[model samples]
Target: MLVTGGTGGLGGAVTAAFIEAGWRTVVPVRKKTSAESRSGAVGRGPGSNRDPKATPAEGDAVYVSADLTDPASVDAAVAVAAGEPAAPLRAVVNLVGGYAASGLVHETPIEDFERMLSLNLRPTYLVTHAALPHLLAAGGAVVCVSSRAAVAPFAGAAGYVTAKAAVVAFANAVAVEYRQRGVRCNTVLPSVIDTPANREAQPDADHSRWVAPADIAKVIHFLCGDESAPTTGATIPVYGRA
Candidate 1:
């Protein structure tokens, strides 16, 4: 599994779910941490030319440095994920995105709208584009994270809604292009994910109505695994009563 945005709130849960399910996960991080950062962490199979990092402790997924928005960087990250024959890249979970609320479409600047589009979709496209060949070879799955607002739009976030809807559309395109060849693509629409950042952003809102990251993670894990082999081009709503 190659999980982009594995260090974020929902992404942390998604990454953990894959690791717990026994997948050899590869996570792309933009920067290195003192404890977790090391070169060639993803493809350390014996006799490999890549430098070997220290053996990761149990349950630790490999981390490779990458700037998700850059095509060259994304390709490098995908290379790391696909380098090991022992752990062929079988799944890709796209969680690298952000939410921005800058008034209505009329009030928002064109630059802001473009920024939202770039932030939400660029990384997803770049990573998926780079990994599609490996996924085709391995007969795997892709789970993209969209949002409920994509379908049910709210005020002050036209750009976000459009970008998220585009993510769903992109996933569907991938599903259509690859299903016969054995790669399945699906999108999960989450509503107000109950992460710390969200809680802090909307403290007065009823957090109980928000979906938990862990719950969404389970759905993503299932979508990428064999259990959802019959599912593709599906838009699953994890609204959690919100």
Candidate 2:
């Protein structure tokens, strides 16, 4: 399994869920933080970590330094994930994205819009493109994390809305292209995720309705498992009453 952005708040929960489920998950992180100094598997690339001192915790996933935006780096991380013959790369969860509310469309700069597109879509495309071969080798699944805003658009975030909608479209396209090839792809549309950053950003808002990271993680875990074998090209909304 390859989980991009497995170092962030929601990503940590996703990684933990996969580990708890006994999958030898592979994580592509920008930098190996102190918490991940003991990364198990190491891959070779421009920004990849090859230090031998790294090791996996009891049931932790393999952490590889990678720049998801870079094709070579993404390929390196996928290689590490598919390295183990016993546990072939069977799943890929693309959670690498950001949300920014600069202003209305007229108030946002072209650079800001392009940056949102690059940040949200580029990594997902690169990682999935690099891992397709391995996923095709054996039956596998791909889960992309979009947002409720993609469907229920809000004010002041045109770039974010467009990028997330693009993600859903991309996932659906992958699903259609690979349906007969034993590769399933789906998208999870989460409402405002309950994370520390979101809480801090909307300190006065009602946090109770926000979806928990663990809750979403469980949904993602289920999507990649055998139970969802019949599911594909689906956009499952994970809005927690928000």
On TM-score, the leading prediction is 2
Q: Which ten residues in a row have the lowest lDDT in candidate 2?
A: 44-53
TM-score per model over all chains: 0.90, 0.91
Return the TM-score for candidate 2, rounded to 2 decimals: 0.91
Candidate 1: C-alpha RMSD to true structure equals 3.8
lDDT of 1 at 172: 95
Give lDDT per model, in order: 0.86, 0.88
lDDT string for model 2 (1-242, tens) is 99988878899899889877777778887875555544333432222342322333333567788999999988998999998887899999999999888899999999999999999999999999999999999889999999998999999999999999999999999999999999999999999899999999899989999899999999999999999999999999998978
Off by over 4 Å in 2: 38-59
Clashing pairs in 2: 38-55
